[model samples]
Target: MRHQDERPEAPWAATNRPPMGWNSWDSYGTTVTEAEVLANARFLAGHDEGVLAAAGWDTVVVDIQWYEPTARPGGYNDDAPVLFDDHGFLQPVPARFPSSAGGRGFAPLASAVHDLGLRFGLHLMRGIARRAVEADLPVPGTPYRTGEIADTSSTCPWNSDCYGLRHDHPGAQAWLDAMVDHVVGWGVDFLKVDDMLAPYHRDAVEALSLAVRRAEQRHGRRVVVSLSPGTELSLAHLEHLREHADLWRVSDDLWDRWPDVEAQLGRMARWAPHSGPAGWADADMLPLGRIGVRAERGEPRHSLLTTDERRALLSLWCLARSPLFVGGDLPTSDAATVADLAHPGLLEVAHRSGGGRELLREGPTGAETAVWGAATPDGATRWVGVFSTAAEARRVRVPAAAAGLPGAPDVVVDVWSGERVPLASAGPATGGDTVLDVEVPAHGVRLLRLGTRAHSGTPGPEEHTWQG
Candidate 1:
C-alpha cells in the first residue's frame, strides 16, 4: 500500500496561502496511540462539526516515534526519538502504526487522513539512517556498510544514537535520495527534518535541499519540506531553505511561556521583509488551549496559560507570521480558546500581511514593549497591536502618521472589543500629531485597525508636546 503522488510540480509552488496543520508531539507526547491520532483526525475532518475542516487544521502529523517506542518512565525526551527498522528501512512501531511495519510504509494512515480531507506529515532527522547503522545493517540495494558511510564523528550534541551525514560522501547523497523516495512515495505532505539547520550543517542542509527537489521532480508531487529548530538563518541559507523548504524555523521550540513567545516575536520582526506567499520564518509551534504535558516545573500537569496568555499566544503567532501548529487537546479545548486561536482577523494578519515591527515604549523590567504593527495590501489600512508588560496598566499611544496615515488625524477601531476610540487632538503646537490612547492592562495588549480620516483635530496647549 505504498502511496505515490503522481501529479505535476504545480502543487508545491501554489500561489496561495501556506499549509496549516496540527502536530501530535505538542499535545499527546509519548503516550499517544494510533487510535488517538485517528480519532483526532476524525474530530478535525470527518464529522459535520469536525474542527479540522471547520477550523482549517488540515495537516495531521505524527511527530517523533513512528519506528519504535519512545522513551519510557522518569523524564522522557519525546522530541527526539529513534525511527528505523531491523532490515535497515524505516517503519512505524507495531503498537502505534501497525500497517507501516510490513514495508507498507504509512499509506494506510495517510490514506485515512486524505479521506478526511487532510494532509499527512511525519518528523525525520537530517543524516543517513542511524538506528540501522548502529546495528551494522546494510543498505537496501547497495553493498555498503551503514556505519562506514555514516559520519560517526559528527553527532548532534543534544541527541545520541545518530551520526551526521558526510555530505560529500556518495553514500550520504544516496541515503537521502532513498529516504525522500520512501516518504514521498508514502504520501507525506509535510516533512519536518531535524538537525538540517539547528546545528547549522551547511553541507547537509544544501544536499538535502537538492535531494528533496529531485524527489519532487521524480514523484511529481507538491511536497513541502520544512527545516526545524534553527535560529537567525543567513540570507544565503534562507534562500537555500526556500529553494527546498516552504518554511523554516527562526527559533528553537516555542513553549506556552510568555518569555519564549516574547523573544521569538522580537527576533522574528527583523525577518519580516523576507516572508512572502510561500517562504516563511517559522517561530515554532503554538502552545495554546489545554496542552497535556507538564511543560513547566511545579506548574499544572496540563496547560498553565490563562485567557490573556492565550490571546498573547495568538498575538505572537500572528505577529511573527509563523506556522500555526496548535499544541492542545482538540477534543477538550473550550470555545473561547478555539475562538481566540482561530480568529479570522488574526489569521489574515499572520498569513496575508506578513507581520511588522514592534515599537518599544516601556517594558516590565523598566524595558519598554509596545507596538506590533503591519501594513496590509489595501495600503490605507494598518494593523496596530500595543502590548504592555509594565508593572501596572499603562496608556499606550499610537501616532497617526507612524501608523501609516498621511497625517496625525486618524481613527482606530479595536478589533478585540469592537470599540471605536478617537485619536488625541492634532495641531502645529503639538507637531500636528494625532495620538490614539489605549490603556493596556499590565502584561496585556490592545489590537487596533487604523483608518485615515478627512480632517479632525483637538487643539493642544502652547506647552503641550508629542513624545517621539
Candidate 2:
C-alpha cells in the first residue's frame, strides 16, 4: 500500500458521506442484463418525477457476475458458476450483452449510462480476478503472471465461486491493483466488491481498499469503492472500510418486511455516527415499486412491498442513512409507487443531510422509533414513527419531553397527511407534562414530523386534541 501522505487526497477526504443510488442485485439478482441496465438508465434520466435522482440516488449500479456463461445440460452454480475469458477479465457474456461482444468489458454499456448523464457501477469479488489467474494471464508491468493463486485457502463461506486474495503473497497486491486498473479503465465510476466482509477477510479487505486508492491515483479520476453484504462486517472492519470505501453495507440483503426493517434499522443506530458527507453505511437496496421477483416456479411477480410497507421501507431507509438503491423493473412499475419514492421532501431527507441519529423511546402504549436526520445545508428533520405493535388499537400517551424537545413541539406535522397538527400554543405551552393520547392501530405506525414553530407558525388545535 502506498503511504497515505504520498497519495493524492481521497475523493471523499474533502467530504465524508455516502453515495446515493440504485443497485440491481437486491431485487433483480443475476438476471440483470446490459439491456435492462440501459433501460433503467434511460428511465431514470428521462423521468422528471425525480424517482431516480431525487433521493440521493444518482448512480445506477449493476451488481454481480458480468461474465459469459456456457450452457450446461444440467443447472448452473448457485454462487454464480461461470467462466471468464482469455484476457483474465470478466467480460459481458456475448449472448446477454451484444454491445460487449468483441472481448471488451462493460465499457460500451457504461458509456451509454454516462451518455444518459448518470454514473455506472460494477460488482466484483476478492482474489486473483479468478478467471484471469486460471488462464495464467501476465500482469501488465511485471513478468509476474497474474495466474498465480495466492491463497485458495480462504474462500467466502457462503459464496463458493472465488477464494480470497492473499494480501501477504508476493504479487497479490499487484494482482488487485491490476484488476482495479482494468475496471477503472472501463469508465466504471463505482465498484461494489463482494465477500470482503462475509468471509471476514480483514487482510484482503484492507488490501482491496489500498488497491482502490492506488487505482484512483493511476487513473487520475474518482472511482468510488463500495463494500457489500453487511452480515459479517464488524464495527472494527466497518470503521476501516469507511476510511477507504465511499460506502459500505451495514446489513445483508434487506427486503420489504417490517420486522426485517426494524432489525436492520436497529443495527444502523450504532452505525449512524459513522455517516458523513462521503462515507455512508448502506442498508442494502430499496425493494419498492414493481419488484420483479421469481416465485417457486419461473413466473415473476410484481413488487413485494405493499403501499404501506413501501412507505415504511422508505422511512426506515431515510432513518438508517442507507443509500437508496432502487431495485425493481422500472419500466413496469405503477405510477403511484414511482411517485411515492420520488417525494422530494422525503428524498431530500434520505439523501443530502438526512444522515443523523435515531432515537427510540418506549411508552406505556408502544415504542416510538424516532429517526432525527439533518436536511440539506442547515436544517434537521425528524421522523417519529409510532407503532402500536399490539393486537388491538393502542392509545399511547405522548409526553412533551419524550419527543426530544424542551416543552411541546411547536409544530407537529403528520408525515402521511402532510398537515400541520399543532402540539403547542404561543409562549411556553407546558413546562410540565403535556400528555397526548395517541391511538395507533394494530401493527400500524403514525409517522409525524417534529419541528419548531416556522417563524410565524402557530400551533394547531389537533396538537393538543385527544383523538378519541
Candidate 3:
C-alpha cells in the first residue's frame, strides 16, 4: 500500500458525497436490454413522473455482460461467446443494444439518459475479455496482442468471460488505457470494475485506477470508479482504497434477506470512518423495491424483506453514509417502496450529516440494539439510528449525551415516520442525561434527527408515542 503523502491528487474523487443511483443487476441480471436500461433511467430521471430524481438518485448503471449477445437471465452463460472489436475492446452486442449496431457503442443510449437529466454508467468485468485474448486481437495503438499481456492463470471463478492482466507486461497498461478511453468516450459518467477485490488484486486495481484517471484527463470528462465483490475486505487496505477507486464494496452482493442485513452491522461499523466523498466502503446495493424479476438469485417478486426489515436496511445505509444503488427494477416497483426511497428526512441524513459511526451495539445476539450517530457538518443537528435486531419487539433507550449530542435536543424528529418522540428525563443511573425511550419493532429501525438548538426544524404534524 502506498503512503498517503505519495498519492497523486485525484480530482475525480471530488464527488464529495456518496452517490445515489439505480442499477440493473438485481432485476435484469446479465440480460438487461437497452430498453430496460432506458426504462429505469427514465424512472430515475423523471422522464415520466419519477420523484426519485429530485431526491438525488441521479446515475443509472447497466451492470455486467453487456457485450455477450447470447446472454440470458438466471446466471451467466459459462464460457460464453462474447463480442469485442478487432482492437480487443468489448462492444455492446448490437442484438441487445441496437443503437450500437454501427460500432456507435453506448453513445446514443448515454445521450438519451443525459437528455432525461441523469448520468450514465456501465459495468466492465476487470481485465481483458477472455475471447479477445483467445482471438489474439491486437491491443489498439500498441504493437502487442491481447494474449501476450493476459495472465491466463488469474480468472474469475464464477465467470469465464475474462482473464486477468499481466501487469509486468508493457502492453498490459496500454490495453486498459485504450479500453477505458473507449468506454468513457461514450459519455459514461460512472464505471464499475468487478472481479478486482475478491482476491485483492493490488496491481490490477492500481493500473485500472490509473487508466480511469488517464482517460478522464484525455477526454476532459469526470468518471466515478467503483471496485466490487469485496468478500472479506480488510481495513488494512484503507489508505490504498482511498487512493484508488471512488467506492469499493466491503462485502459480496447483499440481497434482501434479514441475515444479509444483519451481517452489515459489523461491516459498516468498521468502515464508516473512512467513508466520505469518493472514498466510501460500499455496503452493496439496496436490495429493496421489486427484485429478482430475472435475477442471478431467487424468483421474480417484490423484495423478500418485510417493510420493517427494509426500513432498517435503508436507515443503516444512510446513517452509515454508504452509497445508495437500488438493486430493484424502479419503474415496475410499488408506490410505497418508491416513496420510502424518496422520503426527504431519510435522505437528509445521507446528504447533510457528518461524523457517522456506530455509537454502541449491546444486548444478546438476537436481541441487540445497535445505535449509530451522525451530525450536520456544523454540528447544530444530529442524527441517530436505533435498530432492533431482535426476534420480537422491544423498547430501547439511549441518552442524548451518550449519543454524542451537545445536550438534550429541543426536538427529536424521526427521519422515517416524520413523527416526534419527546425526550424523557432519566434517573441517577444515567447521571441525569435525557434519554429517548421507544418501542422498536423486530428488525425495524427508528431513524432520528435532533436539533440541539431551539426548533431548527419541526417534525411532521402526526405525533406518535412509544410510552409516557
Candidate 4:
C-alpha cells in the first residue's frame, strides 16, 4: 500500500506511469480486422509468464478509422463511408469487426480484451464525424442534431472524416458527452483524440476532456486522454494539458527511420522536464519489429532501422518517460524486438523514475550524442540516457562534473544488458575531470544507471545483447 505523499497527485492519478500498449496503425493501418487485434492482444497479455504485462506494457489501442467499413491499407480513403448509430455516436465497422454487428459496437471486442487483463483503447479524431452530421442524427439524451453542433468550416486538413465542432453550441458538449458515454459503456478505458495538437485546438481539446470527465463521473470508470500529431505543441499550453490529458504526443507520427528517431531527442528533451505523475509527453509509438505489413506509409517489411537503431528507439522512449505504445505486430515481430519490449530495467526508468532532462547535445548535426539524466522515484540514484545522433560511429567523452554525472559512480549498470558498465578510464583525454567515454554507433543509445544502488526488489535485467 502506498503512503499518501507517495501517491500520485494528479486528479486522475490512477494512471501515473506512461500508458504502454500496442497500437494497430503501424502494422495494419486503418484496415486491421478484429482477429488481428485479438491476436496482438493475446501476445501482449503474455500468458507466457506475463512478461510484457509485468513490464507495464498493458494497453491495446485500435487506431484511427475503425468506423470506416471499407477502410484500406496505404492511406485513409478520402470521404470514407463511416458507420454511426442513430445517436450520432460512431460504431465499429461490422465488416472488419464482426462482433460489432447487430448494433453491439465494440462491446464484444472490449470484453475479450478485458478478459485478457488489458485496457482497451480507441482512436478517434476530434469533433463530429461529417457523415453523422450529414445524417443529422440526434445526440443521445439531447434534443440537438449532429449537424447543429458541427462547424463545417473547420475541417481536418489531412482527413475528410470529421468537421470541427462549435464548442459554444450547447449541442457540442452534449454530442461529446454522448459519444464518451457510448464508448465508456463499451469498456473503452483509453481515448486517443487526434488532429487537435498540430495547430493546438484549445476549444476542442477542453470539450473532449470535459466530456470524458463527465462520463467518468457518471459511469465510475476512468478514461485516459491522449492528444496527437504534435506538429508544434507549445510549452505555454503545459498547464492546460495537465488539467485534461494523461499524455500527449510531443512529436509527429514516428516511424522506423533514423531521422524520425533522431528528431525526437530534441523534442523529448524539451518535453521531458514537464513529465511526471501529472502527465507525460509522448514521443510516439515504437515502430520496431515487423512493421509496414499494411502500414499507411510503407510497404510490407520488418522495421527499416538496424539492431542498434531499434534498441535506440526504445531506449530514448524509456529515457523520456514517454508513453510506450508499440507499432508492430507482436506475434510476428522479430525475437529481438519482442525481448526488448519486456526489459524491466529499461521500463523501470520510464515507469518509476523521476522526470528526465537533457544535459548536453554535443557536436554538429548528424555527428553527435546527447546526454539526458533522470533519477529514481526515491531520488537517491540517477539514470542517464546517452544518445548517438551521428551519421557514423564515434566515442563520446562524458565529463562527470561538466555533464552532471557522478565522478565515481557507486554503480555503473547498463540498462539494456543489465550488466555493469566498466569505467576503465574516468576522464577526457586531458584528464582534467572524471569522464566515461562510450562508443555509440550512428543513431544508437546507451542507457546507464549510476550513483547509488538500483531499486530494491526490482526484477532482473530484460537480457539485451546490444552494446555501446
- Model 3 spans with C-alpha error above 4 angstroms: 1-16, 47-50, 452-468
Highest TM-score among the candidates is held by which one? 3
lDDT by residue for model 2 over 172-264, one digit each (tens)? 777677777888888898889887667566787678777777777877767777787778567776556656667788777776566666566
* Sort by TM-score, top down from the best: 3, 4, 1, 2
TM-score of 4: 0.92
Model 4 residue 121 CA deviation (Å) reads 0.2
Cα-based TM-score, every candidate: 0.85, 0.83, 0.93, 0.92
lDDT of 3 by residue, 1-468 (tens): 323333344332432347889999988889888999998888787733666876679999999999988888888888999888888888998878999989899999999999998889999988888888989988877899988999999999889999999999989999998889999999998999999999999999999888887777788767888899999999988888888878999998988899999999989999997788648789999888888988889899899888899989988898888999998888888777888888777776666666789998898887899999987666667888889899788888788776887777777877777678888887887788888888898899888878843232322354221110
Off by over 4 Å in 4: 1-16, 377-379, 424-431, 452-468
Q: What is residue 252's positional error in candidate 4, in angstroms?
A: 1.5
**Clashing pairs counted in every model:** 4, 14, 0, 2
lDDT of each: 0.64, 0.62, 0.84, 0.81
Query: How far in Å is the alpha carbon of 213 misplaced in model 3?
Result: 1.1
What's the true lDDT of residue 327 in model 2? 75
Decoy 1 TM-score against native? 0.85
Give the winner by lDDT: 1 or 4: 4
**How should the candidates be ordered by lDDT, best one leading?**
3, 4, 1, 2
- Model 2 / residue 353 / CA error / Å: 4.0
On lDDT, the leading prediction is 3
